[model samples]
Target: MSMGVGIGRREITGMVVGAVVLALLPMVVQDSYYRHLLIMVFIYGIVASSWDLSLGYAGIFNFGHMALFGIGLYTYGLATTLLGISPWIALLAGGVLAALAAALISLPILRLKGIYVVLVTFAFGQLVVQLIISQSDYTGGNQGLVRIPSFHIPGHNLMRDHKLGFYYIALILLCCSTVFLRLMVRSRLGLAIRALRDNEEYATSRGISISRQRLITMAGSAVFTGLAGAFYGAYFRNASTDVFGASLTTLLLSMVLLGGISTIYGSLLAALLLTIFSEMIAGLGAWRPIVIGVLIILVMLAYPGGLYGAIAAAARALRRLGRRQASP
Candidate 1:
C-alpha cells in the first residue's frame, strides 16, 4: 500500500543479510542451547506467518490455530506409527488432514461476527485438544506420542544431521512459505480473502462467494500451520498433547499480533525478537514468563503495529532522508 509499508530494495537486502547471518549462526554458536533457539525462531516464524494469513489478511481472527496445529502433529504421529510410512509422507498427510478439518468447519463457524467467531473457533480448539487427550488409543492421549520419526529430505535424516542443515531446512521452509503466502494473497483468491475480511456484505453483494473463499483460505492457513507442527514434531521427535496448549497458541498469536497482522515480514521479525528474548529470559530459571510477558506488553504498548511495522516505517524514513541529501 503505502511506501511506509511496502518492502523495497534496501529492505529486501537487509532481510537477505539477516537470513544469511541466521543460516551461519549454528557454525558460530555450537552450543545446542542457542542452536535450538534459532530453530525455534524459524519454526515459530512459519507458524506465526501462517496464522497471519487468516487473522491478519482474512480478518478471521481465529484463536483456534493450536487446534489446526494439534491435528497436524497427531495426524503425522498416527500415520508414521500405524502405516510405517516415512515422516516426510506423514508430514504431507498432516497438512491435508488439517486443511480438510478447517474446510469442514469454516462455513458455519465463520458466519458469526465479532466475539462469537472468536468464541466458536476457540471452543473448537479446546474440543480438538480434549478429543486428542481422550482418544489415547489413537492419539497417545494426554501423555502424548514419543519417538516420533524424523522428517527426511530424500536420503537426509534432518534429525541426525548437522544443526546447520536443520537451520537451512527451516529457513527454506520459512522463505518458501512466505513467498507462497504473498503470491496467494496477491492472486484472485487473495483478493477474495481480503475482501471477505474488509467488507463481507459488500463482497457478498459483488458475488465474492464469501463462504467458498473462507473455506479455501482457512484450509490454506491450516496447511501452513500444520506443516509447521509437523516440522516441530520432527525436530523434537515428540509431540505432547498438553504442550499444544493455549499458551503456545497465544505465543503464535502474539507473534502475529506483535509483528503486524497480515505482514509475513512482521511475523518473522516478531518471532525472532520475541523467541530470542524469551529464551534469554528463560535462562533466569523461575522468572522467565514474568520477564517475557513484561517485554511483550511493553513492545505492544510502544509499537502498536508490531516489530516489522516499525522496521518498515524506519526504512521508508531512511529512504526519504537519502533522497533529500542527494538532491542539490
Candidate 2:
C-alpha cells in the first residue's frame, strides 16, 4: 500500500514540476518566434498523449492514429465551413466523428494481435489520406484547404500567430488532457487497459471483455487526438494531408517509445524535449528524421524503458544513498 502511495506521490510531483516549468516558459524565453515553437509543442503534446492511451496502455500497436486525427481536422473544417456551424460546435463534432471513426475501424481490426493491428491501422491511415486527396469536391483534393476558422474562446482569439493567447489556450487543454488521462489510469478502465495490454488472452479468460475495452480505448484516444487535430487545423489556419501524414504518426510514435511507453507523462516529456531539439537542429531540415531515428535507436539500446525508466532508476539510487547516510 505504501509503495502504491509512493508511486502516486511521485507522479503528482513530476506533473507539478512540469506545470511549473511550462508556467515559467514565457518569462524565461521572451522571443515570439520561440513562443510559437512552444505552442506547437503543446499542440503535438495533445496528440502524443492521446496516442499513449491505446499504444501504451492497451498493448495495442496502432499506427493509423493519425487517420482519426485527420478525420477530426477534415470533419470539423468541412462541417463548419460547409454547414456554417460555429467553431465550438464544429469542435465537438470533430471529436465525436473521430470517436465514431475509431469505432468503425476498430470493430474489425481490434481482434488482431500486435503486428496485424499495426499493419491494418497503417493501411487505414493511408486510405484516409488518399480518400481526402481523391475527393477534391469535399476535401479540396490535393490542393488542401486554407484559412479554416481560428480558435475562439468566448472573447479571446486563440490564433497560432498570436503568441500569448495561443500559449494560454493550449496550456489549458494540455493540463486538462494530462489530468483526465491520469484519472483514467487510476480508474477501473485504466486497470482494464493495463490488463489487456499485458495479456489479452488472460484478460479475456478473466471475463475482462478485451474487445470492448479495445474499442473504448481506441474511441477515447480518437476523441482527444481529434480535438488536437482540430486545434492544429485552426492554428495553421489550414488543413492538409501532409499535416496528418504518416510522418506525424511516426514522430508521435517515437515520442511514446523514446519517452517511455505506457507512461502517462512519457509523451509530454518527449514532445517538449524533441521540440526543443528540433529548434536547435533546424538547419538539418529534412534530415531531422534521421537524427530522431538514430536517437531513438540509441535510447532503446541504452535504456530499455526509455527516459522515465531511467529517471525511476536514478530516483531509486538516490533514495538508497540517503538511506545509507542516515543509517546508524
> Candidates' lDDT values, in order?
0.79, 0.80
**What is the per-residue lDDT of model 1 for residues 1-328, given as tens digits with 9 covering 90 to 100?**
2222244577568768876886777778887667778889988888888889888999986888888888887888878876778888888788888888888769767568888889888888888888888988877887788888876667675546556667776777777777677667767788777887888889899988877778888898888778777777777777887546745665777799888888777888889888887776666875765666666788788878777667778999999999999996
Worst 10 residues of 2 by lDDT: 1-10
List of clashing residue pairs for candidate 2: 136-141
lDDT of 1 at 259: 87
Q: In candidate 2, which residue ranges exceed 4 Å CA deviation?
A: 1-29, 153-161, 312-328
Separately for all candidates shown, the number of backbone clashes (residues 3 or more apart, or on different chains) is 0, 1
- For TM-score, the strongest prediction is 2
Q: For each candidate, what TM-score against the reference? A: 0.84, 0.86
